[model samples]
Target: MKSTVEQLSPTRVKLNVEVPFEELSGDFDRAYQALAQQIRVPGFRPGKAPAKIIEARVGRQAILEQVVNDALPAKYSQALAESETNAISQPEIEVGDLVYGEPLTFSAVVDIRPEITLPDFATVSVEVDPIEISEADVEDQLEELRQRFGTLTAVERGVAEGDFVTLDLSATVDGEPVEDAATEGLSHEVGNGELIEGLDEAVTGLKAGETATFTTTLVAGEHADSEAEVTVTVQSVKVRELPEVDDEFAQLASEFDTADELREDLRRQVSDSKKYEQAGAIRDAVLESLLESVEFPLPEKVVEDEVEATQHQLVHALGHDDEQINRFLEAQGKTREEWDAEAKDEAEKSVRTQLLLDAVADEAETEVGQDELTQQIIMQAQRYGMPPQEFIQQLQNANQIGALYADVRRNKALAGVIGEVTVKDTNGDVIDTATFFGGNDDAEAEAEGDDA
Candidate 1:
């Protein structure tokens, strides 16, 4: 057996392989065994017929066809391994010749990972927003806490912003009632804008038992993208009565005994949250800088597949309705052509980023330990609202464990580069990334144990 590779392009290769007849004996035996189990013979039991007898019964052409079909995958894999090509897509194979006692020849064309010239990480620099927690920020958090402890009191006046209302909602398209669009005694908050569009404006200034009708476009169901007249009738209105922000309230809301202590704790929490936001912004900036400095050709098929997948998800989310898709694009202030172009651009960027990070991971020799992988799995499970074991099983069923491993390696690779890059805040101060992303061995060991 022998193989040779031809470079078709920077991101693609063609392989030519030839296997002598003597090398295919194992394949031939397997093929014969498979056929013997299905074909009946006068003197032989099931799966007991000799190869020569099965071949004689099935004819040489049939036997050869089975052998070729059974052998292609293994042969292709061998050729790929020998050629050292990192194929990123399925190969297009063509058999050239197959004759008894002669060499079997075939050729395969596949997409390969492109060679990338990485930029120097030391030269990369990015500016991020300064971490600042103002008094207003702490106050906002305190207000949210207060709202959580607030009591709802029934009000007799017309509905107002921040007031909760019980209402009946019904909609009609072209004067025909939409069954799924009708509901009775639904609770909604005025000015929340969480329900149908124009609902807040329609319900405002309406007292109990008063109805207001307005026209808005339906976003889902069979009538999606169609204009509908929605009627909202308010049954009752109630306002939230927040507890006073004093030392007594502080004790009830938190472990702190005084309002001043509670405010200080909230400020610290806000500062910690801002640090995380700053770190994220820095990471994005660094990646963007790296991408802008590097130039490489992407595998066209990979980009196309990514773009197709993105479009498929978008369409599926829109319920596979073309009209709804158009309406969504319009609502987003984009045309169909513009949206397509953006999707392709984004897909290309995504592919490039993955390839770049993978190369970085290889260069940095990033290792993803079992503990790290488990942590990633747990985090992803939480994001998807699935149990850890269930998520792990689903990943195994889908054969995505390798993907997760690669993701962890790529993340570690990026983290490894953060030390080499310069990061500054908007106030012209050199930010200390170590404050947020510093590696703590003890913490990691504890986390690993917890995960285990």
Candidate 2:
């Protein structure tokens, strides 16, 4: 077998493949065996008919058609491997006329990964916000901690922000009571805004045993996106009294024995959190910078397929009901046209990023270790709220473990590039990416030793 590639475009190609008649021996044997089982002959058990007899019964033309159909997939795969073509979309195949003794010839047109020119890593630069922890930040964290240890006390007044209230809710749309819209003894915070829109404002300033009515849009169930008149009856109101911030309170809340020591610890925690945020910003900024510096044509089919897949996932999650999907969009204040446009834009960006990272991985020869793969699996599982073992099994069942492996390789490639690029904070201080990117550790150590 031999294959030749015809470059149709930067992102597409045509593969012309030819196989000699001698190579059809194995294909003919398998095809005959399959046909024998399907085509019954008198005085012979199933799959026991002679190949020549079956061919005669089915006609030589039929036999050749079956053989070509059975061999095209393997032949196409082999052609791709030999030609080193990275096909991103399914092929459109056409086969030429086949004579009994002539070679098999076919051609496949496919979308492929485009050739990308990578920018020099050392020339890329990005700026991120500096990590800043102020006194107010530390105090805010301490206040949240104190709230965790707070005690709720019955208040003999109107509901207010931060007040916990017990209430009963009922709603009606067009004077008809909505199904599953009535509940009693529901506990909610006055200003949380978690239950539904307009609930907080309706209940605010309302005293215990008082009721207030307001209009709100239902966000879920059959009545989603419908405006309903909701009546909320406040059963009781209570205020949370936080513990005093003192040495005794510090011992009660945390292991630290002094308030000053706890404040210092809280400051450190806030600083670490800010540093994490800064690192994420740096990574995104550097990626955006590279995206701007590099230019390449993307495979159109790849982008279109990604966009379709994203929409399909949403439709599947909504139980394949178009009405429910539209209601969901309405609740989010988005039109179907806007959603489609946004999906397409996002898909294009995602495809571009994937292509860029894949090229980087190949150029750098990035390697993903077992530990790195496991760590990535664990992180993804946590994001999806699944156990690592269960997530691995699911990935295997879907045959998506290779996709996860590719993700890890791409991440490592980007991390290596980030380490080489110039990254600075908005304050104009050079940021050490080694700590976060896990690259250039030995080099940093050597520099430290030299300084010593």
Candidate 3:
């Protein structure tokens, strides 16, 4: 058996393999065994017929066909291993005619990972928004806390902004009632704008027991993307009455003993939240800088697969309903062609980023520990509102655990570069990335050892 590789392009390769007749004994044995089970012969039980007898009964041509079919996959894999090709996509295999007592020849064309020239990390620079906590930010937090402890008082006036209302809703399209669009005893905030379009405006200025009718386009259900007349009846309107920000109110609402102390704590909380946002912004800016500095050929097949996967997810959510998909596109003001083009562009960017990070991980010799992988899994489980154990089980069932491992590695690789690059805030202050990236793991481990 022998194999050689041909560089078809920067991102693709072709492998030519030849397996002599002597190397195919295993393939022949398996094929004969399979054929023996399917063919009946005189004076022999099922699967008991000799290879020669079975071949004679089925004809040499049939035996050879079975052997070729059974041999291709293993031969292709062996060729890949021997040639050390980094295939990123499935191969398109072509087999030549089999001559008796001659070596079997075949060729496979596949997309390969492209060589990338990584930029110097120390030269990369980015700027992010500075973390600034304002008086208004603290006051906003205080207001939210007060609202949580506020009481809802029954109001004898019309619905107004900041008022909570309990209502009943129903809708009809062309005088035909939309069954799924009717609900009773629904609670809504007047200015929230979370429900149907024009709901807030139509319900405002309407007192209890008054009904207002407005038109809206249905986004889901039987008449999706169609205009429907919606009627909302205000059952009751109530306003929230918040307590004054005094020492007594502070004691009642929080653990703090004074209103000033409570306000100070709220200010600290706001600062911490802003710091988190700034960290995220810095990470994004750094990644953008890296992407702008690097250039490499992307595998077209990989990008196509990503786009197809995105489409599959949407189709699965809609239960394979193309009409619902079209309605969704209409609601977003996008044509099918435009949406497809956008998907392709997004896929290209995504693939490029993954390849870049993968190369970085390779160059850095990044390793993911058990604890880091577990932490990532727990974080993902929390985001999806599932138990960690259940999420792990699902990942194992879907065989996505490896993909998750790669994702974590890629993330760590990107984070590892943060300490080497220069990051500054918009206020011209140098940013300390160690505060967010957790610093070098080796240094931390050394410190722990010293403490021990």
Candidate 4:
């Protein structure tokens, strides 16, 4: 067997493979054995027919086809390994002349990872928003906490902002009632706008037993993207009465005993949250900078697959209803053309990022330990609301453990280079990347042991 590679482009290659008749002996044996089990002979029991008799009955073409089908995958894999090509897409195979007693020849065109020249990490600089928590921020948190513990009191007055209302809603399109759009005794916040558009304004200032009619486009279901007349009848109105901010209130809302202490704790929490946001921003900025610094051609099929998969998921999430998709796009203020363009751009960028990070991992000699892979699986499981063991089993079933390993390797590679890059805050203060992004060997070991 012999194989040679032809570079078709920066991101694609063609492989020419030739196998002598002697080299295909094993394939032939397996093909003949398989055929013996399926074909019946008068004098022989099932699966007991000789290869020569079966070949004479089934014809040489049948055996050759079976041999080609059985040998193509393994031979292609061997060829790829010999050529040292990292293919990203399935190969397009073409068979050549296949005369008896001659060599079996074939060619495969596949997409491969392009070579990328990475820039000096130390030369990259990115500025992120400074972490700042103010009194207003703490107050906002406190307000939300207060709202959670607030009591609702029935009010005889008309509905207003911040008021809760129980109402019956019905919609009609072209004088025909929409059953799915009708509901009774639905509880809603007057100004929340969690429901349909123009609902907040239509429901405001309506007293008990009063009805208000408004027009808005339906956002989901069969009638989505169509304008309808919505009638909302207020059954009752209630106002939220917030508890006074005092020591007693603090004790009820939190473990803290005093309002001042609770406020201080809230401030710390807000500051920590801001730090996380800043860290995320820094990561995004660094990745964008890295992408801009490198240039490489992306596999066209890979990008197309990514885009198609993403679009399919988006549409599926909308129940595969065209009207629902239109309404969603309208809400996002995007047209179909604009969305397609954006999806393609995003897909290209995603492919480029993955390829670049993979190269970086190779250059840095990044290795994903068993513990790190397990930790990643655990984290992803938590995000999907599944047990770690169950998620691991699912990954194994889907043969995606390699994907998880690659993700961890890429993340570690990025972390290894983050400290080399210069990071500063918007206020020009040099930030400590190691403090936030660096890995703690001791902590990681302890966590891994706990997980085990």
Clashes of each: 0, 0, 0, 0
Model 1, residue 25: displacement in angstroms? 1.3
Could you arrange the candidates by lDDT from highest to lowest?
A: 2, 3, 4, 1
Which candidate gets the maximum TM-score versus the true structure? 1
- For model 1, the run of ten residues with the poorest summed lDDT: 434-443
- For residues 1-452, could you state the per-residue lDDT of candidate 2 as single tens digits? 99999999899899999999899989999988988899889999999999889978999988888888888899999999999999988898999998887999999999998888998888888988888778999999999999999999998888889899999999999999986999999999888778998999898899999999999888887687789999999999999999999999999989999999999999999988998898889889988998898899988888999999999999999999988898789777999999999999999999999999999999988889999999999999999999999999999999999989988899888988899999998899999998788876546789999999
Candidate 2: Cα lDDT at 186: 98
- Report the lDDT of model 1 for residue 3: 95
Q: Across residues 90-185, which tens digit of lDDT does each residue of candidate 4 receive? A: 899999977877999999999999998889988999999888878899999999999999999999887899899998999999999999999999
Judge candidate 3 at residue 327 and give its lDDT. Answer: 76
Global local distance difference test of model 1: 0.90
Stretches of model 4 off by over 4 angstroms after superposition:
315-333, 439-452
The per-residue C-alpha lDDT of model 4 at residue 367 equals: 88
Question: Which is better, 1 or 2, measured by TM-score?
Answer: 1
TM-score of each: 0.91, 0.89, 0.89, 0.91
lDDT of 2: 0.91
Candidate 2, residue 379: Cα displacement in angstroms equals 1.6
RMSD of each: 4.5, 3.2, 3.2, 4.4
Q: What is the lDDT of residue 295 in candidate 1?
A: 89
